[model samples]
Target: MSRRPADRQRARVYAWEDRHVAPHGGDLLPFTAMQPMVNAIWAELGLRYPPAVEPLPRQARRLQADANRLRLRVPEQLPSWVLLHELAHALSSTHDGASDGHGPCFMGLYLQLLERYLRLPMAQLAPSLAEAGITWDPAAKPVFLDAAPAR
Candidate 1:
């Protein structure tokens, strides 16, 4: 569960990722449409008891809060990749039974979500993680009782 290397490697691997993409496929998400998309994903992943969604205030560049809530900088732009990244944190923590880690479990679930929901190929994603010395266990995955709702 070493943090630094995995964090650096995750960034390296996703460096090509755009922060935003059209939710329905096209260019980046338009400003007016961003909040709904963000909230939608937040609710979708929150599972049966989805947490409350909050607006990120203007002053904060970062935030500290419990896993029971999702916060977004609404009315401002948000990238799809950023949304997925934060969602992975919540999903991994919830599934892995650990509060936090950038280790295999975290990145594995991150890549899983990307591959599953975004249709990114793991053939390209997994190796770069290994090459960068990130221990990624493919078994690190979230449990779904049935098909996940279409994003």
Candidate 2:
């Protein structure tokens, strides 16, 4: 069966997370444990408010821009990168616009936040996205302030 792009991205992020998580001794990293980090990323992006993260009843991750929150399928066991991915969506809506989807603009925002705010290296994330066939704009600039929304 063919996999959705998001599923592919999730698998890649999860694998990378697994390799890095070994030092923590296999304990599950809960969303609460990662909230501060997510908040920091949100603030670093100069968002007016931190995105709200909550568990969705269904087994699928969703971004609710109008509500200014992320509806996660499994909040308790969310991987750090996945949280960052959702945060990118939140920031995109806040700065870009509520109508933006997963396009070049979104991809650029996602990469910038992941690298600058979440501290994931481009050397690591870029290859992963390439392998997953997710195209992004290398020249896409990240928002550094709330002065204006990005295009």
Candidate 3:
């Protein structure tokens, strides 16, 4: 799994996100605030079930997500952009995403999630993805991207 392109290149992914998407979706939230937000993203993306929002794995040292849970570091790193990245993981896990993990499909969903949730313009996102060497499909967006998140 770690040998996969996206997994191996995850540093580049973080770098890409840092340079391009930072300061865009960094809305900080507490644990109480994040559950509803996570559920909302699940519903918006049409995922069958949202993962449990839990505390960071102590060893994770970073945001983590899977089919069953979205583990986060509380107090310090609770940002929307971080949620978007992990949500993409949760979404991908539902679609048999284990094969590629953080590969194209996952990153594609992350980009679309960014587009939908953060309103980040693809005009800006597209070029940076290339520059960052993070491959993404423009058309890989879900239908929910066209609609606004629940209010």
Candidate 4:
């Protein structure tokens, strides 16, 4: 007898994303709290403009640079790391005009934001990225500004 499709197929599995604990040992930050933080960080980073945070129809988080918006799945818990990644996209888009999408410019911007603003250690971020099947070059240096303007 032939096996049914369901029987033949393996169970569906989703990719594992890195879960980060808040400084106080809490889970992800709610949208209300996170949005303001994004705005402040954007200003602190001296970006030309701040992106608005909006609800995304789907469960994935993404940055829409042209619109200057960050779309995130609503009513879903989002790790701080994930939000930081999206902000990196915003920074890359605004500051980097030379490198193409997700190229060296993007990586440098992301790493700089992660280290400078988020205070995330390379020790932690690198491994988390590797587990997600993304390879990051540790030698990539972040572009520094002459003087970061105060918000």
Q: Pick the candidate with the highest TM-score.
A: 3
For residue 104, model 2's alpha carbon misses the true position, in angstroms, by 1.0
Which stretches of candidate 4 lie above 4 Å from their native place? 1-26, 58-76, 94-99, 122-151
Ranking of all candidate structures by their lDDT, best first: 3, 2, 1, 4
Instruction: Output the TM-score of candidate 2.
Output: 0.54
Task: Output the lDDT of residue 6, model 2.
Answer: 41
**In model 3, which regions exceed 4 Å deviation?**
1-6, 59-77, 95-99, 141-151
By TM-score, rank the candidates, best first: 3, 1, 2, 4
Report lDDT (CA) for all predictions.
0.52, 0.53, 0.66, 0.49
Per-residue lDDT over 1-151 for candidate 2, one digit per residue giving the tens place of the 0 to 100 score: 5432443344444454455322333444585766576666656655545656565455444631122233333346654555555665565454323424455555667677666645667777677667666666777543334435578
- Candidate 4 lDDT over 1-151, as tens digits, reads 5432331111110132224313512357776876787778877765544667766555344532222233333334555655665665555443422222344444555666667756767677666555655444455432323223567
Deviation of model 3 at 51, angstroms: 0.9
The estimated TM-scores of all candidates read: 0.58, 0.54, 0.74, 0.52
Q: How many residue pairs clash per model?
A: 2, 0, 0, 0
Clashes of 4: 0
Candidate 2 vs 3: which has more lDDT:
3
Among all windows of ten consecutive residues in candidate 1, which has the lowest summed lDDT?
64-73
Q: Model 4, residue 17: what's the lDDT?
A: 27
Per-residue CA lDDT of model 3 for 15-129, tens digit only, reads: 8888888778777766687778888877876654566777666666444433323333344347788777777766555332333456676788888888888999877888887
